[model samples]
Target: MAEADAFIFAALQQSGMLEASFQGSSWSVSALTSDAFIAIVFQFLTQLQTSDDNVTFTLPSTLTNTPVGVAARHRVGSKLANILKELGYAGDCGYNHFLYPSEKETRNILSCFLSPQAAEAEDDKFAIIQPQSFLANTLPDVPLSLESVSPGIAGGDVTSGDIIMESVGSSGVATKNVAGEENFMQTQLSEETEEQALEQVQKQVDDTEHRIAAMRKVLDRERGELQQVEQHVLETQTTGQEMQKQLARQKQLITMLPQAQANIAKLESIFQKNAEKKAEIAQQMESARDPLLKEYAQLESQKSNRKARCRQLIREMKTFRSDMLELTGVIHSKMESVRALERIHERQLAKLDKKKDCQDEGPMTRNMYTARIMDIIKQVHKQKQDITKILDDIKGLQKQMNVASEKLKRTEAVAEDKLYTAASKSKTSNSGKSEAYVECYRKFAQVRELFEELIVLVGDVGKKENIARDLQNWISQLEARDSSSHLDKVLADLESVRHENGTLQNELRACSA
Candidate 1:
């Protein structure tokens, strides 16, 4: 029974709610209290984030017969100080304040404290006071009853003490009073320590100032080098832009070169046709000459015969002259075609010149200028889309118009054949029949007029298509030239600038070092 009772008591002790004490109380002076204090301090230090805050201390009579014990108070102050330190305050007094209130209070009880001099230098300056609540002194303990106490402002029934707040103050060194040789020695030692610290700080400040001056000199040198590099880049950019302009001009010429060759071919074709017409005219002239010469021989044989032959030859000669005149007109038309082609070539050259002038205005690599060019490219692209849509719409309309015109042409052709057959038949019939034929012819005229109108409209549409095609071709050629030459030049210029920038960076680093 004795062994069983001992085991039961050990089990109760292990359960931890009950404890073995030296006397009447059940509470044991185990490591748990110290552990609890450490845990509290750890939690407060880890979790606290405040400049000013209140800490509540509960005097738990159940946890101890000695509620206001020195160890307990010390633990409480240490926890509070740890919490304040974690909150970035400068309270230096540790757990000493709780054990000796007067000494701790005079020495500054805060682990995190701030002074007025420090406050003025800060941007968000404000003061705060943390109040400590002693709950056991404010509340009554019931007779022979053990109640667990926890501290807070809310529970007035258990609170036993008034919350005390302290004033804000600064912490610094206190002057020592010298009387004996020991005191004098202590004072001299303290002064020597402070002087040494001040001298070390001064030395650090001087070294820092020297380093700053050296860095400044280096930066100035780098700045000068950068300026020189910038000038070089500017020159490179200018040269690149000039090259780009030439390239653009060449590109424009490239686009028009084929068209120029086509124009020459067209002129040659016209000239060939004219030559064939001239050759045929010459052959006819030669043939006419032979006939006239034969007539001349006949005139010699007989005078009357010669007169008749001569008159016939003269009439044929006149007809030949008329044919020559027609040939001359055809030759003139061919010459005009050649002139038109030459004019077109001249206009293309002029456009190339204009492009060159525009491209040569300045260095294309300027950041602002390149940005503007990009903006222009965007605008051009947008315009191209709009133009393409317009062209598509025009093409759609032209297709419909062509269909309508072809239908009108077929209808007009059928009407004309019917009118021609009816006219011939009406010519052999009576007056009434002739009048009917006239009415039919009038309707045919109206149909012909409608067909003519449709043709005119279709012709107008064709002209518009021609104009649009020409404009689109020009824009495409210009944009292609701009992109290949201008954009490439800009990119080259950018690369040069980037190289210069790298050089400048190296110089800056060297200067810094």
Candidate 2:
């Protein structure tokens, strides 16, 4: 663990992420707070985005050159996470870790930038950090031809030692400077991230298992081919021995020597062809076996990755399970409180029954009552205002959640497209047809998601269809029932209206006269 810490600390220093004042012994994951972590990531990723065209980031609107609020900080963190994901960062890059960094998660994240090789390299020894760590040993093979004029100053054991010692010095600086309380940083993944990570790890395990199986299959095929070749060679040897015996028996004949010579020549030609076929088989075996071996090696490396991930997940699960146990304890305590409150309520009821109070338990003056009433009214108004403000905040948060969810979805889609799909040009210009192929991986993923959504929607649709049919049938029955009664009532009302109109007109005429 110390070695790992040393490695991580050394890397941070080498990459200039950690300052010169930061010492290796003092360096720990606690120093990276939510804001601090986001700032560092933003700085690194912004620089990365500038250098690489492929690396794009979706900046939070509220984020200025300096981010202020927690939400803005989180958005910035998520942006960094998206960028890291797009860049194919291996371990957990979720914003939760940025908000609450763990030693393992922080180290994994730092390694992404300082030692990209850490992911693909078969061993830590093969990482770039290892080379720099052993600069004293490796510098001897270096030629000072570029600085031939000042070879003495340009390259030597002293310079190499300094180069090695510099890392040591940076790590030392980190030790003295990196002081922070360990309690502040939650040294595990958060609750939401845990499920995502478990799924991701399961997928990786399945992939590695599948790859290892395929490699084994290729090796088996190679072994079978090799066995067949050996059997064929054995048969050839037996046939040649028989032919030799036949030629030896016919040696008395004058034509036998020529015949033997002819047989020998034919045998030589056969051997030559056999040799060529053997060479071809060997080449084929070499080609096939090498890739399988490489794949096996890669899988072996991934085995370590999967192990580390599994351990991390186990740790996260353990922490969460403990929290769950604590929650149960809290729930039991609350139940006890509820029972106590019930007893207290019963005692209060008994007291109320025993103690009879006088009617005038209030202030003597009406002015006092008025003042009290006004105070109550003011307090009610204040409470109402507070409620409204709280509701407004809730609405704002809901909007933010919706917007962030949509943004993350769109960003992931674009990131996937950028990371995986390369635009291919047709080989019709003299190259090749570029393999007749159809890749609908992304499309299929979308369709799968659509079908899953449709599954839920179809049930709702069926229910709605039944409801509509019932409503339509009910409405049709209503329309078929009461029309004649309604028409008779309407005719009676029209007759009454005509009589009233005639009376009103005659009254008007008499008034005019």
lDDT per prediction? 0.55, 0.62
Using all chains and alpha carbons, the TM-scores for the candidates as numbered come to 0.21, 0.25
Identify the leading candidate in terms of TM-score.
Answer: 2
Could you list the CA RMSD of all candidates, in the order they appear?
A: 43.2, 42.0
Candidate 2's C-alpha runs over 4 A off are: 19-24, 50-66, 117-483, 487-513
Off by over 4 Å in 1: 1-374, 428-431, 442-513
* Per-residue lDDT of candidate 1, residues 133-246 (tens digit): 222334234211224444343366533322211111111112222246668899999999999999999999999999999999999999999999999999999999999999
Residue 256 C-alpha lDDT in model 2: 50
Model 2 residue 170 lDDT score: 97
Per-residue lDDT, model 2, residue 12, is 60
* lDDT leader: 2
Evaluate model 2: give its lDDT: 0.62
Worst 10 residues of 1 by lDDT: 164-173
